[model samples]
Target: MKISRRFAGLAALLVAGLLGTTVHIVTTAESADAAQTSLRAADPSVLRVGGTYVGVQSVGDNGIAVRQASSPAGLATAAARTVFTDSQRLGEVWAPEIHYDGGRYYIYFTMGAGANHRMYVISSATADSGYGGATKLNLPDDRWAIDGTMFVFNGQRYFVWSGWAGTTNVEQNLYIAKMTSPTTATGSRAVISQPRESWERVVGNPFINEAPEAIKDPNGQLHVTYSANGSWSEQYCIADLRLRAGGDPMYVWDWYKSNGCLFGSNRSTMMAGWDPTLYVNGPGHHSFVLLNGDINTSPPAGSSFPLMFHAVAKGTPYAWSNRYWYTGSFMWWGAITYSRANVPGSTTNTGYSIKFFE
Candidate 1:
């Protein structure tokens, strides 16, 4: 990847470990100020959801300024919009998920450039609109990374994100570390899993494997799923990392796959899936809600319940390029599906459902 002093100078890590490893923390008053100011300058009331995706286009040089969308899906389709954008005129927003906890709405998303991406959080009064500005999380490295997802387990919050080990783009590992506070880090980072398997390492330039999302199984076990391969080539794919209930998410763990491409097309066969986000619209990132009703609370005999997830993608699954940007590449928003066919009901799963407050 291209390197610039401006980018390298942004790293902040103290007391490097034995393996030339360190956790980069860049939480500063200035960055925090920028986030708050962004929220105050913009009219938070303007953002609302359209039918398919959230609709809030940027004015003039701004890109998609107010993104509001309607949610027919169970997740309360609250109105949302961008409270701020940097002077660079490039808006890097992806898969904005709102989680309601302890009577608060936490907005989580990935922000930053190619390899130097970081995850940030902002709070809001409600699940949809009136969101506060983002406070940058102090992650290990400040390099090419994005797609940081948040999950609450057993009353505690944990963060999962994709990061690179070195300047070389050969490896992208999924990491899980405990947050000391709701938005800060405390414990040592763990390399939960890497793209060592053949299915994960796609054949292409800028080889990568990242974008991890995790959900607890009915048995209280953790099933962490992430995408593998190049974002621009056909090697993009998705896989799962598994950990038992008592196991730590920070340690290296073995994962399971669906035995095939969770979602892909006839382009490069494997490397086509990017940014696999999961939500409970009834289905998941791989499945959509065909009908609305009282879902069967119990699994059937000799079989697992088929729970669906609601999701949105930065790009299409099988296509080599994107359509909207028209640059032979780009990311868009949409949905996908995954079936909890074999997972038991008591596994601590998110219930293939969503709860939102308007």
Candidate 2:
């Protein structure tokens, strides 16, 4: 992996202000429409520190677009500068996540045209530039895989993702493996989550559990939130799996599945009653980021952690092409609470009683 020295200074500056600074922005009715227009259907991942951010947008082999923003809200306005396109493998790229570890920035994503899907990694010296070549991660089994992300717990790094349980795509399950390095897996992979719940299984397709994203709460508890139901169904949504502190990530029995969907279709009274002006549907396939502060500047508050996902417009047909980027804030119970109204400073009320910025 190529390491860049420029990031060392920026990283230090970021760490110093990460927990102390709050970002505030005011949105008008027009700004909401602008936000919706900027949204995209792919898995959106962003790394934000103070006013600087690096976001990953999956736009195929032309290489993923790595955009830079001055502030968290500015992400929608920043122009993208493409990277890693020249080195991508023969197929398309999907779900790219950017991480900074050990003085280098690593990008993990899924690649391949069809049933040949697999996870690949590339490195850069800085968060926004100098991307190196791509390398396939070493998985014990070579079944279909996608939406790979990494998290560190107890000082050990682990890779988690959704993959086919067998050669056929009859079923998809969430898996984890310890990492020997940023681009290599060690030992056997453990099946952490599968589609056993009735809501998890789609009518025409195999059971699904994909788009795994790891989040650590204020109490230091570890949780992996994944998308369930079929991606094509309006019922497609997000769910959670919790791991005890210092527990074995490689053991399926060590993770506990939360009750019900954390975020899904219109199950809440607020969502079911949404007005046409404030409607969003099929909210899933998400990643989380901690915005420095609430979007409004008047109320100086602590960090605002929100889930970034894609949703279809209120009256649009449910299709991948119709999905666009949207964000919703969840109250931190022992797990995430997504069914409630807007929290004080973190979320704004959309018509559906969903506290998300559409």
Candidate maximizing lDDT: 2
Which 10-residue span in candidate 2 carries the lowest summed lDDT?
346-355
Model 2 CA deviation exceeding 4 Å by range: 1-37, 86-89, 268-278, 290-301, 335-358
lDDT per residue as tens, model 1, 110-146:
6655554567777655544665566778876555555
lDDT of each: 0.40, 0.64
- Candidate 2 clash total? 4
Give per-residue lDDT, candidate 1, residue 349.
21
Query: How do the residues 242-300 of candidate 2 rate in per-residue lDDT, one tens digit apiece?
Result: 66555577776656665456566546312221212245667777656643211112112
RMSD of each: 17.6, 11.4
The C-alpha stretches of model 1 lying farther than 4 A from their native spots are 1-80, 87-91, 254-260, 266-358
